[model samples]
Each structure stands twice: as C-alpha cells, then as structure tokens.
Target chain A: MTISRVAIIGLGLIGGSIGLAVREMLPGVATTGWDADAAVRRRAAERGLAGTICETAGDAVREAELVILCVPVGAMNAAAEAIAADLVPGTIVSDVGSSKRRVGEALAKTLPGAVVIPAHPVAGTENSGPDAGFPELFRHRWCIVTPDHTAPPAAVEALTQFWEGLGATVEIMDPAHHDLVLAVTSHIPHLIAYTIVGTASDLEDVTRGEVIKYSAGGFRDFTRIAASNPTMWRDVFLSNRDAVLEVLGRFTEDLSLLQRAIRDGDGETLFDLFERTRAIRRSIIEEGQDDARPDFGRTDH
Target chain B: MTISRVAIIGLGLIGGSIGLAVREMLPGVATTGWDADAAVRRRAAERGLAGTICETAGDAVREAELVILCVPVGAMNAAAEAIAADLVPGTIVSDVGSSKRRVGEALAKTLPGAVVIPAHPVAGTENSGPDAGFPELFRHRWCIVTPDHTAPPAAVEALTQFWEGLGATVEIMDPAHHDLVLAVTSHIPHLIAYTIVGTASDLEDVTRGEVIKYSAGGFRDFTRIAASNPTMWRDVFLSNRDAVLEVLGRFTEDLSLLQRAIRDGDGETLFDLFERTRAIRRSIIEEGQDDARPDFGRTDH
Candidate 1:
C-alpha cells in the first residue's frame, strides 16, 4: 500500500514543510492541507504548500490514503476527531508530534479502529507557521515512526516509505521509548533553554540591555532555542509531562552536584565533568548530528 | 601611549588571536608571545601568531610596552609572575581571562606597581589552543575592560585603545560588576550545558548512540557549548565562585517554577516565559550580538 494521496491537518512549519517536500520529492503523490488559522491557510495556499489547500479538515482527509496531524500535541485529539469521519478505512493515520505516547493514545481514543501509526520527524528550526517551512527542511534529518502491534505491517511500510520520500531517514521504535528519548533530546533541552533565557532577562544585577550586549558569550545560543514556538513547546511539556519531568529531575540533580563543586572550589571535579562532556560533543559531530565548525559556523570568524 | 611593542603571554586561542589581530589591525605594532607549553610555542611560531615567538616569558616582555596574559584564570598569577622581572616599568599589563575580578587581583598582586588592566574579550569558539586562533575572532565582539583605581588613566585609555584597534568595541566596567554580568552570560550557561550533556550521556535507559543520533533536537546546541575548553571553564567557575553561585541560585529557582508548571500542566506559565524569551533573542539579533537566522544558521535547513 504505497501512500499516493496525503492530507496534512496543520499548515505550520512541520505540516507546510511536509506539503512542500511531498510535491518536490514525490511528484506522483498528491497533497492536500488545512490549517486552524485562516491566515496560515491563506499563506500556505499562496506559497503553494500543497496541491490542494482544503477549507475544512474533513474535506482534506476524505481522499487521503495517509492523514498526518501536525498540530500541537495537546490538540492531537481534536485534530484526529475532526478528520475521523472522513478518513477512508485502512488509511494510515500518523502525526508529527514531539511526544509519541500521548499523541498515539489521543489519536487512538479519538478515532477508534483507525490504523494509528504515530511518527516524529526530529527536524525543525526556531521558526513556525506556513512561512517558516521549505521543501528541504527534512533532508538528511531523522524521522522516527512508532507503530503499535495493532498497525498492519503493510501500512507501517507505506508510512516509512512516505517519510523516506520526503528526504528523511526513518527509524522504527516503540512509542514509550520514543517519548523517553525525545524527552531527553528535545523536551528537557527546550525547558532548560526557556528557563535560562527567562533567568537571564530577569536578573536585577544584569540589565536586559546588558544581557543582550554580551549574549554572544553563550547565552545567545539558549535564546535561539528559547525563541521556538511558545504554543508548541507549552503543549510538548504538558503532553510529555512524565518523561520531561523524569529527565529534568536527573538534570537538576546533576546541576546541584556541579553547583556544590563550584561552591567548594573543586576544580578537579568540574574539570573531569567538563572534559567528559566534550567526548559526547565529538561523538555528536562525528555522527553528523551537528555542525562541527566552530561556533556552529554561525559567524564568519 | 600608543602600544608599539606588545607582548602576549600564553599562546592559546585568546593570546594567539590577539597576536594575529594586532599584526593584521595594527601593522606598526610588534608582537612577541610565549607559552608554557613547548608544542604550543612551536605551533604558534608556525602560524606566525606573533611577530616573534619568544623562548621564555622574560624575553617576550623585555622590550614590550603592553603585556597581555592569556592563560587559564587559575594560571594568571604564575603567568604574570613569569614576566614580572623583565617588564619595563610602566608597561600596561592586561589579560583575557573570563573572570575579571580574580584576574585583576592576581595581575596586580604578582606585578606590584606595574600598570595592571584586566580585560575580557567576550569572543571565542569551542576550539582552543594555538591552531584554533583566527585574526577575525574579535571582530564585532565586545571587549570589557575593568581597571582598578590604582590603574593610571593613561594606561587604561591605552589598553582600551589597543582592544579597539583589534576590531572590538570596548566597554569600561567595574571588575565585580563584570564578574556578575559574565556569570549570567557565560559561566552559568556553560555549567548548565555541561550538566545537561553529562546527564544525557549517562542515561541508562537511553543508549549513548541514541542521544547522539537525535541530538539535533536541541541537545546538540548545549553540546557545542559544553565542548568549550574544560580547563578554562573550570578555572572560570572557581575564580568567579561568588557570582556564579549567586546567579546559579536564581537560575535554579526559575527552573523550579517552570518544573512545577510542567508538573501541574500550567501551559499558560510556560507559554508566557517562552514568549518573553523570544523578545530577548530578537534584541540580541537587532543589537548584532547573534545571527538572526534560525538555528544560528548552522545547517543548510
């Protein structure tokens, strides 16, 4: 069952990018899209994000062999329910949510007997909305597809091929494990970034102007991450609450240890941890997961 | 006094960059540099990090009008002491340490009565050592100069002018205040990054390969920062203990609030803070402290 017709439920960064990518990479595949926001729908249409920009979610999914919900994780249930009545039987229902377990459960609950195969494309920028996407956004990125025992083997294969057509390498994993991995890699990092940026801005001793001036000193990197879509992140934390809180607990514990080391002037302990962390960085670069260029090659220097 | 003969002690990233910048920006000024590490001195000579790569610190500063120490903050005392006997009276001594207050005090104590001015160029990449130096590192970056009351006005002005000549905008700040500001800007950020990366790497449920494979999901940004020179960061935390601990306390408090919000599913609180941080990011871009492009424009996407 090759996916020939696809419907995207939200025309934000992820949905819009999928629409553009499907058109570019799989020319034979037809695409339709809809957005909750009228302005975004108009912009996605103007940008030619899909072959057809449907006015309603139900209309969008009526002929789709695969329907992908790209809304915030918290809105997955509503998005799934909107298209449930129109989705053809055996259509592989999936999503591009950050948290898999919650989204998978939501979709299943909302659309019983649907072939719900939740997936997460671990690719994005600090930008959102229809204007923030491009066809190449998923190129060379990873898209993890999580399928439960209920999903047919053919539908799972079709969803994997569909993501591959959009220029992403696909990995199969359990929904529970996906949630935990993403919590460490995405959710907790975003939470920490948001916290630090807020902390920097509210410091009484350091004015916001001063923080802005010296931000190149490392704070700016966190600011970029913190600038991510607030609605999306708020929903991510809420939906992936258990995993995020678990990893966050470990992070806080580790932080306290480092703080104690600093207080005691324990240079050896600090140096050991700092040095050890560098090996992980090298592994990340070697794996092509990050830019190896100094300062991520952000500036000319 | 115009700095005609400048000496840079400790030929690492900051020192080598200073030498190369001075040679390129102020051709009339001569640069002599010495590093405690023999291999580094050899590398510095091959790269022409300075006009003259001296065999000893005494020789490096003997004929110099301005001396800049670029060693780890913990080594500032020894680096300063190494050149004390050879320094010509009234030579303005400065350093490029991240922590200013301790460095200022260390320089003043080791080279009594000599003009000591401490400055920190808030510029660098994760790479360190002589080979990592680039002439353009300081271009468009801020260099904060902190001179005590004992520093002569003329010497402070000359030091400020020297930094300006290297394509840096110089801001005069109190050493204590500079410590406080940098704690928020650099030290705490590094500490948090190191802690988070360590936490990710040590997770039992998540394989190390899994962490690296999905790092682009925001964990990679922190890894880049955590990969910075470990010795330098260790010294920075130790030297700026008071300020680092104080600001860290504030950050922990902020994290706790956000953690509670996540636990309570308080999306409104998370959304508010996330939205507020975007303004800071915009200001950093507008002020030219960071690249406005998303993800620091690190990847093609």
Candidate 2:
C-alpha cells in the first residue's frame, strides 16, 4: 500500500510541487521528474524537486508505481499519447489539471492499458515554474479524484492516499460534476476577471495610468486573478468550454439584471444583494476555507 | 500653519481612522471626535480614538480650526447642516467621503463660513467602527482634494500638511473630475464585485456552498470588494450615478465581446485578452501600487 516510487511528468509548478510535497511527507520515497524544458528539469533537480531527474518521459515513469501527468490540459492528450507506450502496466496515472473530464477521457482513450486516476489538486497561484513550487502548496487544499467505473479500486485507493498524504483533503466525484462545479468556481471567475481587467487595460491614456496606481480600489483584485498563468487558463476555458459558457451565460444574465437595478437607482435591490454576499464571506471564514481574522484572518499586518 | 486642533464628525471607519492617524502622527494635536450614535462615540472614546469625544457635532467643531466630515455622502450634507452654525469664521472644513461633486456642493452650500476643501482618501476596509481604526491606514494612500476656487490658500496648505503628516500624498483636482476618475477606478469595480458575488450566492443551494468553499479561485477577491461599507458604497453609486453608469456601460460591452469569444471557442481571443491584462498587473507591481503577492496586495493578509 505504500507509494515508494513516484514519477512526476512535468517540472512546472504543480508537478514540481508534487515532488516536493511527497519528499517532505514521505521521506525515503524515491522520486523521478522530467519535463520537455531542460532548464526547468535542471532547476527541479537543483532545488530537490525530485530525488532524480530522468532523461526522458519513459525513463521517468519506467519503474514508478504512480505517474502524475501535470501538464496543461490542452497538451494533456498529446502528452498522454506520447507516454502511452512507455507507462508500465498497473501504473496509476493521475494529473493536476483543472478540468477533470477532458483529462480523464484523454487518458482513457490514449493509455487504455494503464490504470488512470484523473485527479485535480484544486489549488494554485498566479505563479508558475519549478521555483514557485512549494512543498506545502497542496496542504489542506481539496484534491478531487474523478475515477470512472473502469478505474480499478486499488488504483483509486492508492492515488487517493498519495494525494491525502500530501495534506490534500481528497474527495471523489464524477468528472462531469467536477467540470460543472469548477466551471462556476474557477473557470468562469478567471474568465470574468480576465475580461474586466482587459477592459480597463484598454482605457484612455490618463485613466489607464490611474487604474494601475489606484488599483487598491478594487480593480487590482481582478488583475491578480487575470495574472494567472495564461496558457493554463486558456487551456481551461477551451477544455471546459461547454460548462464555462453555460455558467458564464448565467452570470451575464444576472449581471444585466443588476446593471438595470443600478441604472434605475434600485437601492433596495443593490443593498439586498450586497448584504447576502457578506454572508458568503462569513461562511468561507467558518468553513476554514479562509482565515477567520479580518482580511483572510491576518491579525496583524 | 499648524493644524493643532481638529474635529472629526460622524465617527465611523474614516472619522475614527483620521482621529487615530492624527493622534499617532502628531502627538500634541488636539482631536475632537463626534458621532450621532452615542454607542459609536462611546466606543471611540473607550478606544482613545481622539483626544476627546465631543457630546455634540457642534461642540466638536466650535473650537476647532479644522473640521473633517467623515460620513457617508448621503449624510454629508445633513452632517454639514448640523455643524455649520458652530463652525468658526475662516475655519477649514473638509470631508473624507467619496463622490467629491456631491460632497463639495454640500460643503459650499452649508459651510460657507468655513474654507471648504473636500477630500476623498482612496483607502478603507470592509470593517467599521472605532476598533477597526488604524493610524497606518492612511499612510501610502492617495487623498484627493477638490478645492473650491475661493478656498483660502492657508486653509489648503494647512489641510495638505495634515494629510502629509499622516504619510499621505495629496492630489488636487476638480470635484467633477474626481468623481469621474473614481467612478471608473473605484465605484464601478465595487459595484461589479457586489453583483457577481451576489449572483454566485443566488445560485442553487448545492452550488452556492461550493462557490464559497472554492472561492480562492477568484470569487473570494470579489467578496472582499463586495464586503466593503454598504451605506458608503450605496451613497457612492447614487451620488456618482452618471459616471458609474457610463463606466459600467463600457465594462458590459467588453464583457459581451468576451462572452461571444467564449461561446465561439475563440481560444486565441481569450488568450490575447488574458495576456494583455497581465501587463496591467505588471505595471501595478512595477509602480509599487501593489505588492506582487496574493490577496491583491493586502500585505497584512
């Protein structure tokens, strides 16, 4: 039941982070890492992202019991196609992709011989690359494992333990449900942030400068969200295109309604909406999703 | 000229914060604070929010050479109406409310005896009351002064020194210009955050919980903006109605373009917009407008 040998198939934030988390939590575990970019692999090796830097995808996953495919979702199918021939029989294949359904389907289709356990560690920063990866990045974060009926019980249990051992609270859900939930939580929000900040970036000269200088007002929050990895987000929107558009359509309809309320000076409606949103922050605090202290529970600045 | 004696009316977040800042930065300055709510006044007094808590608004202004109206824009006129009778001749009166045009008009009409220099400190938090007051809150922030044509030179200089002493950078602009800039930078962003978070909260029950739980994706940023002072924001939207609506119109148009792009699976368009917005965050970071850290540069959090 012990996961001794782990191979991470990318040295970017998530893959390198998984290597670091496993090393810290499961000392003595042999870990191998690989990436198409030699510099990232070098950094991962120098920073101890893995116990060993393998020469190729095949070399990385050759003897490992678990192989985590932590590449962009748009590239996941291609990566799966490339590694399908190299992945050992009974090797548990998982990923750290934002979208579960597409990655799972790609894995099932491209690497049917391997035991695929498509899991998403629902955590990240607007940061990327090997240097940005932290051992505790996944700690206490949710990692939902979407294992279809075809996924073996032993494979699911082993992959779940691997994620749980890294301090993630593992949950099981269908890939389609996962896509819908994330469409609301992650994809749509990122899309909207990108749009609003993009809009402001296009403002007239004077206002554009003020927009950046006075970003503390609120526009900066969207910029931070918009600053998220472009390729990853681009892949997310493309991969979860259907669910994202569905939720996004709902959001636009609601936005228009509120816009009408504001345009009409419907103070009661605006105030009511405002008050209800406050409770969401409180609930987030109570759920341990955020710090209870003011401003993400930071007691002191 | 030394701003030795100061009166802060309607002791909420801004009032109490100004009182706290003055006391901290200028130890010998005399700060007289007043609020309509006896409970609020008591809390300010208990927290030593000022040198003394005045029994009435008039009492707070009677002996002060400088007076700051730190109340909602809606209440600014009424608050000025209450204290105008006791304001000394040539006394410098200003405000710490948003929407400079409305507040400036209220000042000119109600406090003609005082030298009116309406200001808006573009800084605040969602928390209110005396306990939330912090001296450093005004430091490193912009304080916009909308000075009237007849505003005495000495009064403007004195108010400028008062803000500078608290580590603020003051910018002088016309009242309408201030309103328009803020509507684009602050008001519309706050309104957008409130609406989107509100829209997410009104989602079906199961989804609503997930929204709050996984809010770190981007929705949490909106919640913080949405959690801002309701009455103050309500006043902001109402007072600066035209500007907010105008900026909001631009935003909706941009959003609609994005909606079409997403619907059409235009990955290139989404990526381009997302990439362009990244430069805005970079500019903010380069200008030191925000720390290149999480939670939109709230270093405390």
lDDT of 1 by residue, A75-192 (tens): 8888887887888777788999999987888788888857999999999999998999889888888999999898899999999999988888999999989999999998899999
Q: Which residue segments of model 2 deviate by more than 4 Å?
A: A296-301, B294-301
Residue A21's lDDT within candidate 2 is 85
| Best candidate according to DockQ | 1
Task: Please list the residue runs of candidate 1 whose C-alpha ends up more than 4 Å from where it truly belongs after superposition.
Answer: none
DockQ of each: 0.83, 0.55
CAPRI classification of candidate 1: high
lDDT by residue (tens digit), candidate 1, B1-301: 7889999999888999999998899999999999999999999999999999999999999998999999999998889888988888888888899999878877788898578989999999999999999999999999999998888888888888888999999999999999999999999999999999999999999999999889889999999889999999999999999999999999999999998998898889999999999999888888888887777877734
- Backbone N/Cα/C clashes per model: 0, 1
* TM-score (chain A only) for the predictions, listed in order: 0.98, 0.96
- Clash pairs, model 2 backbone: A293-A297
Query: What are the per-residue Cα lDDT tens digits for candidate 2 across B1-301?
Result: 7788999997887888888888888887899989988999899999888898989999999999889988888888889888988888889888888898877877888877778899988777777776887887778778888898888777898898899888788888888877778876778778878877876776673378778666666667678778877777878887888877777788889988877876787889888887788888889788765656644333221
Interface RMSD of 1: 1.1
Predicted model with the maximum TM-score: 1
Q: lDDT of each model, Cα atoms only? A: 0.91, 0.80
Q: Which lDDT value does model 2 have at A187? A: 84
